[model samples]
Target: MAGLHLAQLNIGRLRYEVGDPRMAEFIDNLAFVNDLAERSPGFVWRYEDDSGSAIETRPFASDPRMAINLSVWDSVEALERFVWQTVHKRFYGRRHEWFERMDERYFVMWWVPAEHRPTVQEAVERLRHLRQHGPSDHAFGWESLPAAQLWKSARCA
Candidate 1:
């Protein structure tokens, strides 16, 4: 038996208050987008609730002004296929239409063992570590996979 690979997710804000009048409409559209993903192919699972949010234990940033949307995915191909191939790619391209280009630190990816979904706090810590240290000895992204794949029986059904 082997552990599953999870896509550690993170998306930052454009401005301080993304829910402001100017951005409210866009934020509201998130529900529609999420709904699309929930039913997307390769969508093993997503973290959200009726309120259209999952919980976050960390401050969006050191200033605490920004916020993050973190979630898990079954695989990099799955997530990338969604983010790039899907309509979602348009929003990502236009993110600067809202968000600031801080650094690579703004978005990151890491691996997690199956059955051990990370908490917001843990995700934050992993991002912080990635910033302080480089990719080695800890986390990596879509471009990197272990020499050996850790495949497991599908729990999807």
Candidate 2:
């Protein structure tokens, strides 16, 4: 916790375009969620564009509907608390209504120096490493956490 921060990247395939009627609810809630994260305890940083929304930044040029979120927190516990113990959990519960099911693991987490902010390419590379090599100290998911770890409280059921 002294020198390291947790960096995470999660990519989702959207079932519909951001402006589509089907995605309206998700779109409407995006700002609120973003602001919540900004105010959440232990929040460090999040990737955003000039509009302060990451949704418009298409990381995967081939798929216009691919949405990615990259953020940093003081620890896994901080991130888990925000994700599982807040209103964000409600939207997360309804993710399937806005996002398509992904066949592969779409999330990855790794440790970074507290002062370091990860780039999109670096986050993608870590995700690729996890996909190709499975979890390790370099890249991991909730499954990689030890049973006694704080992640247990935040782990998805």
Which one wins on TM-score? 2
Which ten contiguous residues of candidate 1 have the minimum total lDDT? 148-157
Runs in model 2 with CA error above 4 Å? 147-157
lDDT of 2 by residue, 1-157 (tens): 5799999998999999888999999988889999999999999999987667788877778999998889999987788888888898888879999999888889999999999999988998999999999999999997775532544554442
User: What is the alpha-carbon lDDT for the whole of candidate 1?
Assistant: 0.59
lDDT per residue, candidate 1, 7-26, as tens digits?
46565645646446866655
Residue 56, candidate 2: how far off, in angstroms? 1.0
Per-prediction TM-score: 0.76, 0.92
Which segments of candidate 1 are over 4 A away from where they belong? Answer: 54-58, 145-157
All candidates' lDDT scores?
0.59, 0.86
List CA RMSD, all candidates. 6.9, 2.1
